[model samples]
Target: MTFFTFVTRGLTRRPVRTGLTIVGIAIGIAAVVGLVGISRGFETSWQTGMKSRGTDIVVSNMGRGLTPKPFSATVVERITPLPHVAETCALLVDLISVEKADMMIVSARQWGGFSWKNLKIVSGRLPNDAAERAVVLGKTAAEVLGKKVGDTLQLETEELAVVGIVDGGAVVEDGSVILSLPLLQEITGNQGKINIVDLRVTPRTTKEELTRLCAQITGLVPEARAVIAGDHIRDSQAYRMISAMSWGTSLLAVLVGVLGVMNTMLMTVFERTQEICVLLAIGWKRSRIVRMVLWESALLGFLGGVGGVLIGVVGVQLLVTTPAIRGLLEPELNPQFLVMAVAIAVVVGVVSGVYPAWRSSRLTPSHALHG
Candidate 1:
């Protein structure tokens, strides 16, 4: 029989053990796929929301927490006149309980700013004036908060009328509770203090000019940093922590898979000692025996990876549907990440087989023939 056929036969000889090994590796890979996907998805959602709002650059005092630190709203004055800056919108962003224990994002924008232009109303209309005690809910937030256009929503000590329901065109945007900056500031005791500034550049702005503008903004406002909207999340402390935790947890899971695969391969080698000895006696090279064991483990890893991807997909779907995650962001399994996961699994398989393959090669023909 051919070498490939020989490897297949060995694996099939004990289906139950092989199946269990595949399952162990599969669970490991599934954790990598699900956790990493959600973390990456969070970054993408914020970037997409910035783009949808026509924001080209962001200025903020980034902090350890997910939200930026509050800065004086007057900082916008330092940014409006530098070349290529078309408009600037100051915002006060916070996370607080809209209901009992249901903490949610509250996005309060400067009234009549360009930031308000992109909000497409699905029902009702925009608040009449900046001083009006009213708010708008993104479609997802409305569903989560269980409020309609005419409902009175409580915000700390104040109650604001919900005047409109909007579709913000991005997951992060659609999951927010939106209102006028002044109103949020008054209720949250952050009057005249805003945390984020979204900038829109003139149509004629070039890449070099944009870079210059960012540097200029940072230079003028020493307390805050300026970055292109897309790069904002990548540069944040919270994103880095999320990324590190995701990979660290995944690595632990992968190590478990490696140990499981190693144990299974070792057991298989021990059980098939006589068969390996017969091959050696018939002039099969020790290298060939080593290759046989390696091939079997690699095949197991390949199957596990495929199964893991499927499990990860289902897990992410269920996770996103929970109340805590329902409107935060949409998690998607990226093609590039999926391919990388399978590659990792294949490497894991080869590494796992090394010790077992070496042990198989150490079996002598004479010793095995008698036993």
Candidate 2:
């Protein structure tokens, strides 16, 4: 029989064992691919969202550690007319419970001049002006609250009329409620006070130059400090913890799968001992014998990888559509991730086959014929 025919027949010899081994490896590969994809997607989404804000510099009050401190309204007013500053707006964030459901509250000024590229009004319309008590609800948040445009939402201190439904196409924004600065201040009991400032610098301003300018601003205003929002410094610690947990869990799954493949390859080598001996007896060189065994293992690995990638794609689809898991982390299945998964599977197959292939090649023809 030709080499291809022999390999095909060998796999067919024990269909159940081969199938189970393939599945084991596939589960591991799928875990790795899915986790990596989700993590990358979250990081990308965060960066993109920050970029959409179009704020070159962020100024906030210095609080404990990296947590944000509330800045006074006076501080916000002082920096509005700083050199090279085209426009500035104050943003206030709070954790509020609405109808017993916890939600994030975001309040920003009208025409205080910052812009969001992705914040689009899908229904109704934006508030008439910043001073208006109207609010915009993110699509997901609206669904969760069982609310729609024209509904009145009662908060701690005031009632807000839902003027529009926001569809930012981003997971983070989809879970927030945006309102006018004046209205937010009234609800939070912080009237005439600002918490954060988003500043847009001139075209000539570089990030480094902006940093220096921020330092100068901080010196000028002792009550407030400047920060770079895109740096992710605010959530770095939290993200690191989350990333480490994800990677650890994924690695463990992949390791279990690799062990399954290795065990299967080893057993296959033992089962084919006499056949290998016959090949040696017929003048098949040790090198060729080893190559053939290795090839079989590699093929199994490749198949497992392909199956795993397919499964991962399905998992991603489910994740995106599932409401409970949506926005927590979204998995992006890209060509690069698929290619890498397949390549890694092939490599794992070769490595797993090495010991089994070596053992088979070492068998003597006389011993095999006698058996």
Candidate 3:
């Protein structure tokens, strides 16, 4: 019989136990796929949105690396006259945690400006009254909050009316509420203060010119730093933390899978002690026995990898389609990441088999057969 057939026969001896071991490995891989996939999707979506918007540069207070200090909205006046600056808009951003629900970071944006043009309203209209407490929801924010046009949400002490829903396609905006800059300023008690200043530059502005302008903008306000829109994501500590957590959590799941495989292979070695001894007595080399045990473990891991991929796909689909997480999370199934999951499983299998395989190979035929 072929080597693979031999390994297959051994695995089939206890089909139920083998199946359970495969499932144990599968669960770990699925966790890695889902968590890491979602985080990567979030990063890609945010970066794409940042670049797609015609806005060329972003200006924000360069305070603590993660926490940007708010600057006076009047800084827009200083930035507008800078060379290559076509338009400027001030933004106020903050996180509002709904009682018993996920926290949403909402943006208070300048209405009737070039920066606002990118937002396409799906249903309803932009807020007409900047003075009134009016808010617009991104497709995801609406679903998460379960609010629609004309519905009122009590934000802090004030009740704000939802005037519109937008499809911005950016995860950050899609999962957020938007309000008129003035209203947000009033609500946050930081009137005439802002968090970000986005700038659009004239067409044909060279990269060198853009760099010079960024330096000039920084000089204009010693507290503020200007950077390319895409680079802003790199500067964000929260984004880095999320990325770290995704892989970090995945590592734990992989470790659990390793342990499961190790336990299962060890048990298999003990149960097959007599069979292994007979093979040894018949002149099967110790190295050959080691290879057989490893091959069996590898097969189990491969099967588990396939099952894990399926589970991850189905689970992510269900999550993204559900109203609560739909707009907020767009799970990405990157081919490389899926491949890595399978590779991890194979490695875990091989590593887990080593000790058990070695112990079985060392058992003398006399002792193994008599025991």
Candidate 4:
């Protein structure tokens, strides 16, 4: 029988063992693929969330990194006139503790541009620029608070009217309450002080250039710090943590699976010892024996890899549809990631087969028959 045919028949002969091996490999592959997909998904969601704001650079108080510190409103006026700056708006972010409910409050001025990229009004009109104490509820925020358009919600120390509902198409934003900049400023008691300066720069400005510009802006005003979109320091830290944890766990799983593959191949080699010896006695070259064994190992590996890819795809799909898990990590199944996963699986198969193939090739036919 040809090498391929022999390998195929051998795998069929031990269906239960092969199936278990494939399952083990598939679990490992699925872990790797799902982690990678989630990582990429996080990146996509972060970028998408930032882009939805339509601001090129986000300037916030460089205080303790988490708390919002108010900067002078003049800072916004000053940055707006700078070269390459398209527009600038003041932002106020604060934590509002309501009766039995605490939530983040984001209030921005209507004067600054808003990117409607991902924002959709689901069930109400936009907040009026002229109305004081008016607020817009994010979809999630509305759901959680059990508040809807036309409902009155009290935030911080002030009660505000919910005029509109805004959905940012993301979990983070969907959980925030948006109000007019002026109203937000008044409620926070930082009338002339802004917590963030959102800027829209010219499209030609690179992140590096924006950083440098922001540095200069910070120099102009020490309390303010500029952060580029997609490179928010806090967000970057979060991404790194998620990526590291995901990959580390995946690598461990893969290592265990590889060990299983090694064990299976070794057992197969011992069971076929007599057959290997006969092949050598028939004048089959050692190289040919090695190739045959290696090919069989490879066939097993390929089958396992295929099974893994299938399992991983299904797992990712299930994860995306799950609300709690989906919020934690967004997984984008990019084509490139899929291709890389397959390639890695193939390489893993080849590597796992090498040692067993060598041992099979070294057996002497006479010694085997005598035993």
lDDT of 2 by residue, 1-371 (tens): 78877666766789999899888878878887788777766666555545666767777763542225566777767787777777776777554566635444354553444554357888998788877877887787778677799999777767889988888666656666777777777777877777677777888877687888788778878877776666543444555565676778777876776787778878987888888888899999999888887888888888889998988788877876564545433466789988998888888888888888888878898866585
Candidate 2, after superposition: displacement of residue 223 in Å? 10
Top-scoring candidate (lDDT): 1
lDDT of each candidate versus the true structure: 0.89, 0.73, 0.80, 0.71
Q: Candidate order by TM-score, highest to lowest?
A: 1, 3, 2, 4
Q: What is the C-alpha lDDT profile of model 4 across 1-371, one tens digit per residue?
A: 66688777766777888788878777877888888777777677655666777778877764543335777888877788777788776766664554334434454654434543346898887665545667777776777677888889877677788888888777556766777767777776777877777778887987678878878777777776777766653444455676888888877877766777777878888888888888789888999878776777677667777777788889888866553443333577777887777666666666777898888877888965676
Residue pairs with backbone overlap in model 2: none
Candidate 2's displacement at residue 235, Å, is: 5.8
Model 4 lDDT at residue 267: 85
Give the 10-residue window scoring lowest on summed lDDT in candidate 3: 60-69
| TM-scores of the models, in the order given | 0.96, 0.79, 0.84, 0.76
User: In model 2, what is the error at residue 339, expressed in angstroms?
Assistant: 1.6
Sorted by lDDT (best first), the order is 1, 3, 2, 4
Deviation in angstroms for 53 in model 4?
Answer: 3.1
User: Model 3 off-target regions past 4 Å?
Assistant: 61-69, 74-85, 98-101, 202-227, 321-324, 365-371
How does residue 348 of candidate 4 score in lDDT? 68
